[model samples]
Every structure is written in C-alpha cells, then in structure tokens.
Target chain A: MKTLFDKIWEKHVVESITNGPDVLYIDRQLIHEVTSPQAFAGLRKRGISVFRPQQVTATPDHNTPTLNQHLPIKEEASRKAVEALRENCAANNIMLFDLNTEYNGVVHIVGPELGLTQPGMTIVCGDSHTATHGAFGSIAFGIGTSEVEMALATQCLLQSKPKQMRITIDGNLGKGVTAKDVILYIIAQLTANGGTGYFVEYAGSAFRSMTMEERMTMCNMSIEMGARGGLIAPDETTFAYVKNRKFAPQGEEWSKKLLEWKLLFTDSNASFDKEYSFKAEDVKPFITYGTNPGMGIAIDGNIPVNEPNVKALEYMNFAAGEKLLGKPVDYVFIGSCTNGRIEDFRAAASIIKGRKKAENIFAYIVPGSKSVEKQAREEGLIEIFESAGFVFRQPGCSACLAMNEDKVPAGKYCVSTSNRNFEGRQGVGARTLLASPLTAAAAAVTGKITDPRELI
Target chain B: MQKLTILTSPCVPLNVESVDTDQIIPARFLKTTNREGFGKNLFRDWRYDSEDQPKSDFVLNSAKYSGQILVAGKNFGCGSSREHAAWAIADYGFRAVISPLFADIFKGNALNNGVLPIQVSENFVQTLFAEIEKNPKTEVTIDLPAQKITINSINLSEYFDINDYKKTCFINGYDDIDYLLSIKEKIEHYEVQKS
Candidate 1:
C-alpha cells in the first residue's frame, strides 16, 4: 500500500538505476559549526564550488558558548570549527548566521522561525535535530559531515524509502497535559525502538487539536523513537503559523500555496505498513528508568521488576517495584532542541514562580537560542526562574548531551528536559531521567520526582 | 580513480531492529575530535560489558560469523545525528548495510562515505536472517552494477536511488569537491554566461 510517506518519497525519487542508488533532489540544506569543517575541507580538497549556494544555510550553535557570547570561544578546537565555518561560507558564497547575529541561534530554531521551513519541502541538516523542522509538514532529517559536503557541492542526496507507520492518538488530552506530555507518553508506549523501520505520521483528534509549535515538538521527538522522521498533515494551524513568517509566500501567493498544502493530508483510507492507535487520556507525564529513551514509565508507575532485562536494571541500579515518586534528584536541566523554546520556559516558570529550590538540588535553565532568551526576558520568565534558585544560562545546546563543560558529574541523577537519557549521555556514570520542562521544574522545587500537574 | 565497488560477504548478519546511532557509536564516545580510529569502539557499549570488556552475549563477539557486509533488521542508524556513527560502522569494514529501514540522516551519511545501504522488503529481510541463522556462513552476493543481492539460490534485486552528481562521485571514488572540480569548465561557462 502507498502511504503518504511513500507517496512523498516516491515523488521526490528522481531515478533508481539498476544495482545503484536513487538520485534524490534536495530542497533545503542546513549546516552548523560542529560538522561543517570536515565537509568544507572535503570541498577544498576537490577545489569545487557550491552547486546551489542559495538553498543552503549555515549557523554556529553546537560549539557556541552559552555563558557569554561576547567573549571569544574558550576552547581552541571549538573556536577553529566556528572560524572554519565562517571561512567556508564566505568562500562558497553560502549564507551564514554567525554568533550574536540577529539571525543566529540553534539551527533547528532559526530554521523554523525564519519561515525557511515550509510544507512538503525536503530539509536536511548536519545536525540530527533537523527533524525539528518536520513540524512544517516537511520531510526533514539529519545527515553526516560527508553528506553535508555532498549537499553543499550539489543540492541532492541518495536515499532509500522508509516504511510508514501511523500513530493515531484519539480522544481528548486531559487537563494540564501539554504536547510535551503527549510525546513523552507516546515514547513510553512505543519504547525507543518501537518505531523502527518506519516514517511515522501522527494523526487523530489529539494531534489535530495541537498548535503548530506543539505539533513541532511532537515531530521533533519522532527521531528519538527510531523513526526516520515524523509529520502531520498541513492544516489551518500550520497555515496560520507560516502566514506571517519571513519566507512564506505573501498575499495572493500565500492563498494559492495554502490551497496546495491543504491537500497534503493522508486519504481517508490511507494505509500504513504498521499502525497503532491510543486514547490521549491514557497518556501521562513520563520519565526514563534506563539508559535508553525507550526505558520509560509513567510518573506514578513503579519501575518494572522483570528479571529478563537484568542488564538494564543493573545499569540503572533500580530495584523492582520501587515507586519513582519522591526519588531524590541531584540536578535539574531544562533545555535542548526538545524543550528549549519560549513555551517550554513559560511552562517551567509557571511551576517555579514564588517557590524555592530544594537545598540539595542544582537547576540550570538554558534557552534554545538567543531569541528564545530574549523572549524569556521580555516575559520576565527569567526573574521567576532566578528567584526560584534556577541558574539562567545563555542560549546554546547546553548540557543536552554534554558536549561542553556543562555536564552532570559521575553517579549523580538528573531530571532533564533534553532528549535521550541513554547511559552516560550527560557524562560517564550520570543517570538522566527525561521529562518535560514543567516536570523538571517541579522536580527542582521539590528536590524529588513529582508530577507537574500538582503545580498546575 | 576507479569507482568503489562494495562486495558483500554473507557471514555477517545483523538481525536487530532499529539499530540507532547511539548503539552504533554512543554519545559518550563523541567527545573526541579524532575520526580515524573509531572502528574498535563501534557498538562498544552494546558489544561489550560494563567493565569495558567484551560481552560474550553480544552477537558481534560470537565466533561463528565475521564478514564485511552487515544484514540488519529494520530502521538501522536511528537516533542522534552523529556522523561519527556512520564513520565507525564503515571503518569497521562493513561496506554494505542491508536493512528493512534506515534513519534518514544515517542513510545520507552512509552513502556519502561510499558505504552502500540497501533497503529490502520485510519478508526478504526475514528470509535472509533465517538463512543466516540456519547456516552461519551463508554467503550473499551484492552486484553493484546489477543492483541485486543474491542469497542461497534465489536472486532478488533492489534499486538505491542517488542524485546524478553523487552517482558519478561514488562510481569514480570522487568525494564532493572532486565531483565539483570535474565540472569546473561547466561552472566557469555558466559564470561567464551570467556575466
């Protein structure tokens, strides 16, 4: 059966030669500081110019220091990487959003905000979180350094189609349940590997009720579940979000474009290779108990006591039948592509306002981008966070996967809003419990695991 | 330079579904800037014990099979977008990765590195896994020219779609810049025409 993913994939598949790979036309290519150096080196080695400079955009985020953007980069290797991107962009005639620039921020955040991401476009970036753009109804995903080079030199790619899976969330979401909770709940249901071999299309009443930003948040985490990418059909919410954006078609052109995008949904009887449907009310705030994102359970649920997964139990150092409630946390980190946006800050602040942090807990609130930070300050969210003993850090991918100095020490437990709670993801021997920003803030206030619904 | 042709040996069969990039090369190993020597650490956490020792329980450590081509279950190279994951897999001498599905980014990275990633039907993948389990040393042939993979006596063919430019580069062992340089004359002509 031809699913929507298959339909889109086949339409973009240029040609498939016998015993060879398919030729795919790339619509958009995004680059960042961390991975673009080698790609530029590859380009210089061959002395070739960029094939389609206008279609590609580069930014410095992964290695950009969040503490003080004005100061030069403290790490030499990171400095060189950022400099190399600047030089490469200059030489290749590519557009670059340098640090401190108005357009500069996390590649994922900047891409969507700039209206560069549109429905039905195929977007690729050097960062895996590129899937964040899939909220715009595009087939967005990450690529490697070499592939980044390939796209820079030639705006095209070689790709095989993925199987399609439909995750239909029926019914209405319970009160105080945000899109973050919905995705966390879905992750708990599917496990981390449940979506393997598929491009997931999130459907049903619950998805249709979500705002465009909430939909983006849901699609952003699709990669965490091993899906190639996640998409939602373009609807009025999507149209309204892109209407006033910078890159969206304006005036009469926008009306025409919206008409075309309106037809992007799955047919009434569209078939998928696999399907799973659940009621939204069944979902709850979830957290991970093991190293992988798949090892998730409801906030109030007890840890699984099964012996067959003994290795996981040992690594997590968790006993069977133990309730996760009141579990002491050493730290709380709220940031990353997953939950580093303005709404995420508001959610966390709402919980922490007029509250004091637990004596033993250290919390860090890092925004996704400079713009996010600006918005937070304008909303006075930072005051609420600081008053509650949360450290307000600058914008960057801070402590998400611990690429920089911000990391949880060995043997400590942290409740984080970042994606991926895999063993040692934040640091060697560090335990991460993935949660929503609200849940993380709730943990910070109580110094223990607690549901955000209580604060709401 | 001649085109890089990937010849598959059937001994190595990967049957796990959704083999994410984290499993290929974990986030902890991504701290280093070096790219040349990651093959040993490929799937280190999964293939080894907590004491940094090899786990006898892992499939890679089994003595029955060792080959260049990896035949995996579905959704290979999922999770975070670390190019090092693809590099580690390719450096580990796995020239071709056959699976029912692949993460979008990992697929691009794999192909760019000259590692052929083939996607087949679920039934075909299951049959291949079953055959490998029955005979650990069962051989499969991947003919790049024919774009077909043969297991046992049955021959099944699948096509991998790539861009025309990338196709030339892969066939000629030309990286991104090399492909572009080869067309320097054409680019110059275009620039002159625009001027």
Candidate 2:
C-alpha cells in the first residue's frame, strides 16, 4: 500500500542519482515577476531556451498595483521587472497572462481557477505559496530562483524526496472556524520548524469536508509551518471543482482524467513517516499575536505567559497573558493567495452586510484574481463591501506583502487575512495580526480584535 | 559558483529567533531585476533608521562584529521562498550561515547560491553564541571535505552534516543547472516514455 505522496512522487522521479537528489519531472510550472526575471536572464545568458515552454505560465503579481490595472506600472523598478517577464515569456514562447487579462490575478489562484493545477501532477513555482495548489492532490512545492532556472531549462528539479507527514483532523468545525483557523491552530501546535524536511498530507473528515477553495487556503500556509508543501487526497469535491474550468479536460478526455484522479487517495494501511491527529472541535477562530504564524492562539484565548519569544512579543507590542479581544486595530486586510477567493469574500460579506466599517478602521477587501473579482461582483459582494464603507480593490498580492501602495503604516495594527505576521511584512515597522476573512471582517466592523463567533 | 572547502573566519551573531526572509531583505527592495546590489539593503529595516542612516546598535553597523560567517538563531529564513534572502546574505559577503534550524526552502536557496547553510545541534549553537559573546574575535573553521566545524579559540569541534552530492558540488564549484543540462538526453528520454 502506497501513500498518496509516494504514488505521485514515484511517477515524477525521472532519474535518481545514487546518494543524491532525484531529477523529478515537472508537469506544470508557474512563474511570477519576483523570482522568474533572474531565472530568465540566466537562460538568456546561457543561450538556452525553455525546454517545455507550453507547460509554463507567467504573470506579474507581487509588484503589480491592485488599482488601475489599465495604466502603466508607476514604479520604474517594478515596471522593468514585469517588462522583463513579458519579454522573457515572449522570447520563450510561454503563455502570458499579463496584468488586466481576464486570467490574471495571483499566480497561485490563477493556476487552480484555470484548472492548470490537476491531481497527480507535479507543480513547482518560484513563489513559496505554490503549496496552495496542493489542494488538488498534486505534489506542488516552492523553489528558489536557481531551481526555477533549472526547471525552465530542463522541465525538472534536482530534489531529495522529503519525509512524509499526515496531519489528520476529524469532526465538524464549529461556527466562525475556517480552514485558516484550523491551519493556524495546527501550525501553533507543530511550531514553525516542526514540519521541516517533510511534505504533509492533510487527511481525515475535517479536511475531507473542506471545499476546494478552503483546502487551497489550508495548504497555502504549509510553508508557514515549515513544511515543504501540503496536500489532501482528491475526492468528489476535487472532481466537481475541476469539471468545467478553462483548462480542464472536456468531453471524453474528462472521464479518462477523472478515473486517474479518483485513484489519488492513500491506500489502506499506508504509513507516513510522521502522523498527528487533531480534533476540529479544538480549532477555534484563531489569530496570530506574534511575528510567526506558528505563534497563534484562538480568539478570546490568552497569550502564554511562559512563552519566551520576547522579540516577537516586542515587535507585536503584545504582552503575556493579555487577551486579544477588543484590542485596537487600525486596518483590516482580506486578501492574498490564502483567503482571496470568492467564498472568502462571501464569508466576509456575510458578517459585513449593512454594517458600516468602524471609523478607525481602513478596511480593504481585495480579490485574489480577476476571475474572483468578477465572481464577487456577480455575487454583489463588492456592493456589500462598498456600502459598508470597506474599500474594494482589484486583485493582486496586495497588502499581504505590501509590495504596492496598500500598506499599513508603522506602529499600526492590521487584522490581516493573509499568511505571515513577520515584522515589516505588511510594510516597514507595520504590526500584523493574521486571522480569517471573517475575523478580519469582524475587526473591520469593530475596529478591534473581536471574536467572529459573536457576529456569526 | 566559487569553490568552497576549508574556510576560516570570524562569525557575526544575530541573536534573534524566527528571522524571516522579510527581515533579511524587505519586499520593497525586491523589485530590481539585478541581484548584485542587495547587500546594501541586507536587513534594511534593522540596519537602518527611517531617515536612511545606519542604526548604531545593529550588529552589521558595529565595528565589533565583522565576519564572512553569520551565526543566527533557530528557524532562520522561515517565510517567503524568495531567493533574494539568500542573495542578500551572499551579497553582504556572508559565505556561510550556521543555525540550529533552517526553513527548508531557504536552506535549498542558500545551498544553490553557494551560501553554506550549516545545521547543528541546539546546544552547539548555544555554545557557539556563548563563545562569541565572550570573545568577538572567536574564529570558526568550516572544513567541508571533512564535514566538520571547529572553534579555533575554544578548541571545541563538531562534525556537521552535508549531503554528499552538495559537498561534492561545493568542493568542485558545480551547480544544479550544470548537472541538469548534462543529462538533457535522459530528461528527454523520460518525457518520451511517460507520454
């Protein structure tokens, strides 16, 4: 009996070097502005071309401004970086989803929504959150620029197979608890370094019940807990989600692909190198109080007095044993690869409908992709947000890493729905508290950290 | 890649935990296509003030600490798989980083970029910090061929671990792309068989 990870991994292992890393074949490659420029330049320097250009897709997300997609990128450096990507893609004959294109959004979001990320495939992107695509039962992981170039040149990566870990969460989640909370709680329990050198497969009833989008959010933060990547076994939820997307198989090809995907589950009695089980009941709507995602506690829970992460505490301006409930917040961000999907917007709209944003809160509701933005508008989540005094912005990796104009000023507290609360992540000296979109919505309405269950 | 084997140098100690990539090189500096100038902004937030002046208290700014090696706290390079973090460290003239734990992607990036990421025991890390605290001039020697690191002043030595292939690459100054391109025929063969 082979585990799901082993099955996919073995298929992708092209040639294994004795006592060395395996040359793993990649079925799909996703590239973005931040990491691909250097890689493309390396190719140009070598007088080489991409080995399999058709399998690769390129977009500019990290530095793209969320507002004014029709206008030229204002920052010269960012403009050059993006222009370099476009130039490289054109030269390499790779597909380009330029900014303002219907398919353009966050690279990770755009991949799955377009059905380019399929089960049993090996996907690698330069960006770490490439794990977000693991929701579809693929062996997807992030790579550095060097590996990016290697993949671009050979359509393979020289990688050592990581140990396998299965994190099982059972039982139904209570109100206000989201996939983001479950992941945050799991990371808190495991610590950021606990999953180092391992690829995790999330199993059991709770993960089985999460929607494809929710599962995307769950696997998206695997890097935060130090896992190389994370995935879940594909089921009907997976098949239904992949049915009619732009890139998904059509007609007779669909049945053949479905048969292959249906077999993408872990066999009975297949053992993982490590295993941990958590109850969904224990996972509450959580928020991080420190610099790392692993330093999270449930809303209404007290910060640990004995926790010795003094630097994190000082950076967040938080004290031991202090409750985060009702703590003042200056901004609320509800977007990123983690929570920038349509359901996230719907969830935020559920709590924010007819409620004006707090006077002290500058709430920004940005979609993850152009498709998600269109869907939100179709569902009138934008109207709900705009009416509630929350600014609705276009899609990009905005405020999450704050590469663009959407920044939280220094010494300001923002309840963000994106991953990572590291200092200067939102902006230089900006304090970030990571939470779910619902929790971010609650903070936007109350202008403080409040339990979303109260509104639910 | 520069050939690295036996190297001796004093180390810079960053006594901070969970030092994410954002801290190593903030996102604002990541827009540039060129990777050479990142050293100037390495740890930009911590090394400089809002007015763009160097912070006197930061380790890099202090004359007491100057080294090609950076000894950092646990879970170094935790967030964002941006190779720019490895670029900034290498650009700042740090040839090696010693830590108790390293985020996986960062370790890979560091190794690929010719920045030696040496993972040692927690106790060993603590001892090194203590030794450095007592004497800023403490010298650490990384003997890559022997898979060992020695603290010359304290006479304490420990055998570190590196993948045999990576050790070979370091000594020979080879990169993944070179190996991959050499096996271009094999890759093409595998693709044909799979299809």
Report how far off residue A394 is in candidate 2 (Å).
Answer: 0.7
Instruction: Return the DockQ of model 2.
Output: 0.88
* lDDT (Cα, tens digit) per residue for candidate 2, span A1-456: 999999999998988998889999999999999999899889889999999999999888998898888999998888888899999899899998999988999999999999999999999999999999999999999999999999999999999999999999999999999999999999999998889889999999999899999999999999998999999999999999999999999999999999988889899899999999999999999999999999999999999989799888998889999999999999999999999999999999999998989999987788999999999999999999999887789889999999988899999999999998999999988999999999999999988899999988
In model 1, where do residues sit more than 4 Å from their true spots?
A1-13, A16-22, B1-20, B26-37, B40-76, B92-108, B114-195
TM-score of each: 0.83, 0.99
Q: Assess each model's interface with DockQ, reporting 2 decimals per model.
A: 0.25, 0.88
TM-score of chain A of 1: 0.96
Residues A1-456 of candidate 1 have per-residue lDDT tens digits of 445565556555545545445545567898887777777777667777788898888888777777878888887777777788899889888899898877777788888877888887789987777778878778887778777777777666655566788999988887667777788788777877677657889999999988776887898888788776898887888888788887778988888878778767787787888899999889888887776677778888888766344555676678877888888999999988888888889988988999999998987788887788889999999999888877798877777777666788877889998888766677666788989888899999999999888988
**What tens-digit string does per-residue lDDT give for candidate 2 at B26-133?**
999999887678999999999999999999999999898888999999999988999999999999999999998999999999999889999988888899999999
**What CAPRI-style quality would you assign to candidate 2?**
high
Error of 1 at A272 (Å): 2.4
